[model samples]
Target: MAVLLHLDSSLFPLENSGSRQLTDAFRRTWQEAHPQGSVIYRDLAADRVPHLDAATVAADTLPPLRRQLIAEFEKADVVLIGAPMYNFTVPSTLKAWLDQIILAGRTFGEGVPASGKRVVVASSRGGSYRPGTPRAGFEFDTNYLEKVLGDALGLRVEVITRELTLAPVTPAMAALIPQAEESARQSLLRAAESAREHAALVS
Candidate 1:
């Protein structure tokens, strides 16, 4: 059976988190498409991986947790990540998880074990970051992931972005609330569509 590794890094709960909703939509669609597939889920905010340390880097042997994380990543047929931008970048917990699994000689370097695997990232940010937007240059979350997960690790990276998420709560962003809602709706649709498309390739 196919295996999906899902990682959620949103700090807020489902009801309040746009990234969670997008990822959940993808997961649900994926489940429907692969009735017997297995899902491995991690809520990074609640169970954060330790940041990489000197001991992990200098040790003669791989740390147990790092080994396990790598194994899990290699086992996955697909990876779904809910990455809500915090301070113009990915959550620290997500970064920690990346540090654990990105083994140079294994998952990254020559003969990359994760090559060709599909990773759909549900990326949500408070403001617009598309090209031509005023804050486009400030976008580091999805762009960083594309480089690390795709260019470096060789995973096939696909991102569904939900922007202007702060519009609902910030008084100054009130005028963009409609755009935020539309962005969210489109993100959910894109997530489901992408999940089904990827699921068809699992077998």
Candidate 2:
């Protein structure tokens, strides 16, 4: 059976979270298609991984949590991530998780021949950062995730991001609420599409 590792890094309640909603959309469709497939869920906000330290970097052995994380990652045929942008970047918990995955000899090294795994990232940003916007290149979360999941880990990463997610409450962004809703709708569509595509490959 295909194994999917689903991760959520949202700091807010699920009902109020865009990234959570997007990832949930993909999981629902994917489970519908692959009835017997297994999903391993990890909520980073609730159970944050410890930040990497000098001991982790200097020693050949990994910490217990990191070892477990790496094992789960290695076993997953698909990885689904809900990354909520925080302070101009991905949540620190997410970063900690990624740090564990980018292992030296285990995940990558000479003769390792790339992971070639598939990952889907459902991301959300509170403000507008589309190209040509004043904060255009300020987006650090999705881009960093793409590079690490693709280049460093050798995974085929597909991303769907919803922006201006704070429109409901932010007075200044209230005018762009429609656009935010549209972005969310489009992201959900993309998530479903990608889930189907992944199901076809595995199932």
Candidate 3:
């Protein structure tokens, strides 16, 4: 049976969270494609994972939570993450989850167990961060994920981004609401398409 590990780190609910919306689209499509498949979900913001501490780092054996997280990650055919940009990066909750699963010899370094796994990231940002944009340099969320999850962990990373997410709520960005809506629409489409493709590939 195929498995999908879904993680949502949005502080807001599905209706209010752009990242959650995208990830929900992906998950729904994936489930439709694979009715018998399994989905392991984690609402990171609500049930936050503990941050890496000295005891965990210094422990000779992997902690129970770390082991469980790693097992789930390794078992998944596709990993979907809802990573809303908080201060230009992923939420601390998501980071904590990553820290737990990323073991040097196991998931990170040479002969990585998670190598070639597909990871889809639903990224939502308040402002535009495309190349040549004013705030392009501040686009750390996706870049950092690509670096850590793709380059380092050797996962096949796919990102679906909804930019200018604040336009609908922030008075200052009112003019870009249309663009933001369009971005969100396109991102949702991409999420569904990506999920379908992965479902087929996994099958």
Candidate 4:
């Protein structure tokens, strides 16, 4: 049966997390298109995956949580990840989940199918960090994930980003509120479209 696997790493509660909210929008539409399909949900912030240690060296000997994560990825036709930019990079919790899934002998290796799965990355940024901006070079979340998911693992990856999340609350960014609202609307539109398009792959 077709399955959707989702990971949410936002530190804030789901009601207040932009990344989570975007992912939810995608999931809702996706489910409407495939109501009979199964769904797997993992909340990394509430139940963080442990960092790699001696016990995590081999795929066959992975801990229960790590093994479960990999198994879910293996069965998933669609994977949704909530990646809120933290410290200019992916949240450490999300990174930990990636480390567990990117096993050389399992998820990746010579002669393996180059990812039959579709991956959606819902990215949320607190500030405006696009190209040509003063801090453009510091934007790392989407770039890093694209390389790892698209280049490294060969999954079909689509990234939809919501920026300037702090504009309404940060005194310094109050001037950007209008732009932030537009960005949010555009991001939601793109995410919904993407979900509708890719929902066919698993439906």
Candidate 5:
């Protein structure tokens, strides 16, 4: 059976954040499309993966830790990440999780080697940062994820952003919430479809 790795970094679960809801919706759609597939879930909030520290950095270079994480990464064909942008970047928890998975020679190597993996990042933010918008400068989180996962790790990457714009709610911000949520849901569905197609091609 195909494997789908699900990583949820939202502190609020599905109750408070539009991002989690969007991810959940995507999960359901993906499950429907690939009924025989199995999902492995990693909840970063409840079971936090430690950030790369002195110990972890050292461990990463060692053969044991490198083999362990690489084994995990190799087992999954599809990776689904539910992340919330914090202060114009990925949440520290998600970054920590990424640190563990990104082994220089394991996930990638010289000559642009491909891992033949697919990753979907579902992110939520409180502002509008789409390109061409004035606030687009705040898009470091999504961009960084794409660059790191795709270029560095050699995983095909897709992103779905859920703009809350509801917190710190000004009248203008409040007006965009409904449309933004709808857009996010649609994007997530599209990502799910893409994942299904990619999984089929790989299988």
Candidate 6:
């Protein structure tokens, strides 16, 4: 049975945000596909992870907490992250969580062969940032996530972004909300399906 780590960092719950709603839908679909698989869900909003300070950073090189966090990461075959873009970047809580899991010589060895894991990030944004759009240059969240997970940690990273540009109440905005929501739902389903397929392949 595959172990999946599901991390939710949205400040808002499913009732108010597209990110949480899509993540829930994806989880249901994934569960249906893999009935025997186990999922460990972590809500950063309800239980916050402490930010790494100077002391923590200094001790990170030889800390038991680092080992504990790495053990959790190694236990999971798949990692699913539901991240909401805040001010064009990841939430602080998610950043803190990342800091905890990304350890040198554990998650990745700096000078040795790269042997990291895989991660899928499902992100929600209030505006469109796809390439060729004016807002595309402002997409620091997805870019930062990919870079951090792939370059720094040596993890294979895949990203799916659900932009809610059309959710506003104005006439023009109201016309696009349904379309945006549908797009988001489809993206979530596709990502979950891909993860299931990848899990089967690896197994």
Which residue pairs in candidate 6 collide? Answer: none
Error of 3 at 146 (Å): 0.4
* Prediction 6 TM-score vs. true: 0.86
Task: Give one digit per residue, the lDDT tens place, for model 1 in 1-203.
Answer: 99999999999999899999999999999999998999999999999999999999999999999999989999999999999999999999999999999887888888656579999999999889999999889999999999999999988999999999999999999999999999998999999999999899995
User: Where is model 3 more than 4 Å wrong at Cα?
Assistant: 111-114
| Runs off by more than 4 Å, candidate 1 | 111-114
Clashes of 4: 0
TM-score of each: 0.97, 0.95, 0.97, 0.95, 0.85, 0.86
lDDT score, candidate 3, position 82: 96
Query: For model 2, what is the alpha-carbon lDDT of residue 85?
Result: 88
Per-residue lDDT of candidate 3, residues 37-63 (tens digit) = 999999999999999999999999998
Q: What do the candidate models score in CA lDDT, each in turn?
A: 0.94, 0.90, 0.93, 0.89, 0.76, 0.77
Instruction: Rate residue 32 of model 3 by lDDT.
Output: 98
lDDT of 2 by residue, 1-203 (tens): 99999999999887899999999999999998888899999999999988888988888777788889999999999999999889889999999998887887678767678868999999999987778999978889998999888887789999899988999889988899999989988998999999988988888
Candidate 2, which segments miss by more than 4 Å at Cα? none
- Model 3: ten consecutive residues of lowest lDDT: 107-116
In model 1, the clashing pairs are none
lDDT of 4: 0.89
Model 3 TM-score, all chains together: 0.97
Worst 10 residues of 1 by lDDT: 106-115
Each candidate structure's count of clashing pairs:
0, 0, 0, 0, 0, 0
